[model samples]
Target: MAKFTGDTAKKILANEINVQTLLHQHPEYQEEVLRELSIMKGSYDLKRIQAMMNKYTSSAKLAGNLIYKSGFNEKTVNTFLPNIIKARMALHLLEHASIAASAQSPTKNVRFNLWDGMVLQRLLFSKGFERKPVSLGLFNFCWKFVLNKKILMPLVNQKGIYCFYSKALIRELIRLIGDKKCLEIAAGDGTLTRFLNDAHARCKATDDYSWEHYITYPDFVEQADAKAALFKYTPEVVLCSWPVPQNTYEKHVFKTSSVKLYIVIGTRNPAFTGDFGAYNEAEQFTMELNERLSSLILPPSNENAVYIFRRKEH
Candidate 1:
């Protein structure tokens, strides 16, 4: 592990260095260089190094040649390789963080290993080691490092359990609804519920617990269908973030007399209208429902939209 001091971190931030440059410049650390290079080979562009190695020596003499070229005579290649690999891994993390920060949808298909690589790179660069291997490592490290900071949520899709939802989205939701009695239907793992609680809302997170592994925070959870739960809680505000397909139970809640406000977070696609035997009668249903509600707020976004309904004042 590289002991990163304040000065080292500052140097990395200033120069934007990484592990790749470090390895290339300090050829004397050939064993370390090779080890780091090997780990990052599949991820980054290592063709240049590979070509150099191929031109210089045979498979058996590879380690010997590296040591000779790197200017290290006393150290064994085997010992050096591990440290090099670790450094490279760190660099990759940094690279990932950099990429993630600049990304539009940062949570899309994020991987943990990639984030780790970026962190390593950032640490190395911060240490003021401006070598080729180190520089490349720095870029890689920043990319991966920022990725680690992301809030990972357990998503339940048709295929099964997966990770989705960005911290930004969660933050936005918190800001939207402050402290209120909230109900989240089709709440997988109670992610939104937890977010609501963190925002100081009196929220009850509920889910069917159908998945093999379900996530729930220390909150009230009832194993019931969305419609049934609505009848029990009759919350002031109802929130559903990305409800399952064809779940007409939402419509049932919309018609309920108890709900003061109903919020549906999802796309505008009509496919979300579940088999409540109501697609053909959507116009009639919506008109009747809208008549009952005082206010309705709809935002225009292809992937995400928020529908808010307010109860009519007596």
Candidate 2:
């Protein structure tokens, strides 16, 4: 019987020491291992789960790896893997969505479906990604965004998913802005800007770069938070995608005198996205959901719409 130390736990997590082999070598350590597994299952720390999720190919593979390493019982593995897999799927969907949204030519219009399985498999588990995890996919699809949305909704509620914009929506937005200087704040990878820019709309993508975990901030995405960006750009039109619920930065957009139109791409449900509290408090602007524009958001399941806010006359 050997004592299980912090070093042992660290080695277990690092994969420096294989749990099955370790337990086989020292059966007495089983109780200690079980305790550690319990802690991991209970914590479900976002960073830790994300790290694990990145290293594996899919939810099934990830769950299998965790179960194999922990050498846990069937009951324990069942309780642990389901939720962890769901979170992992959500993260994967967001990562791929960002990649799809940032496509060089958004007008080509991407859609997701069962046909993408082969491409998805290769990107997720092929040789090129053996040394490093696949952060971006070659294409983006909205139809069947992921194998399971049951796994995606939990994270979407907490951290909203990025949706690809339609050409129609982009054209309409361009028509509305019609020469007004535009700025997109919190633009994850500048997906909307890619479409708007391609359409010759004068818009710049800006973000605080806080979501580096899920989004790889490209060179084109200007590194500025909403308030600082609003102050610097002082554009008449402002655009944002899926602003966090009860956010503090959007309020500044309302206060900025230069902004005449504030466009937000998000769900109507306050619980899903956008700073609703700020929207309600802005007496100076009138908010309306553009149905024609909303239909352009891919997959329809996202329930996302283009919200146009026009400043009321004094």
**Which candidate number maximizes lDDT?**
2
Query: Residues 1-314, candidate 2, lDDT per residue (tens digit)?
Result: 23344444344333344323544565444544344334445444444433543443354446556665777555546544443333333333333333333332422333334544444445433342121122322323432545643332232222324554555566778898898899999887676786688778899999877667666677999988787888898999999987754444688899999999999988786534666768898999999998877877643554777788999997
Off by over 4 Å in 2: 1-114, 118-161
Candidate 2's error at 284, in angstroms?
0.5
TM value for model 2: 0.55
Q: Which 10-residue window of candidate 2 scores lowest in summed lDDT?
A: 128-137
Q: Tell me the tens digit of each residue's lDDT in model 1 across 223-285.
A: 656766777888777776655433335665666666766665554443332222332333323
C-alpha lDDT of all candidate models, in order: 0.45, 0.61
lDDT of 1 at 264: 59
For candidate 1, the lDDT comes to 0.45
Give the C-alpha miss distance for residue 53 in model 2, angstroms: 26
Residue ranges of candidate 1 with Cα displaced over 4 Å: 1-176, 213-220, 272-302, 312-314
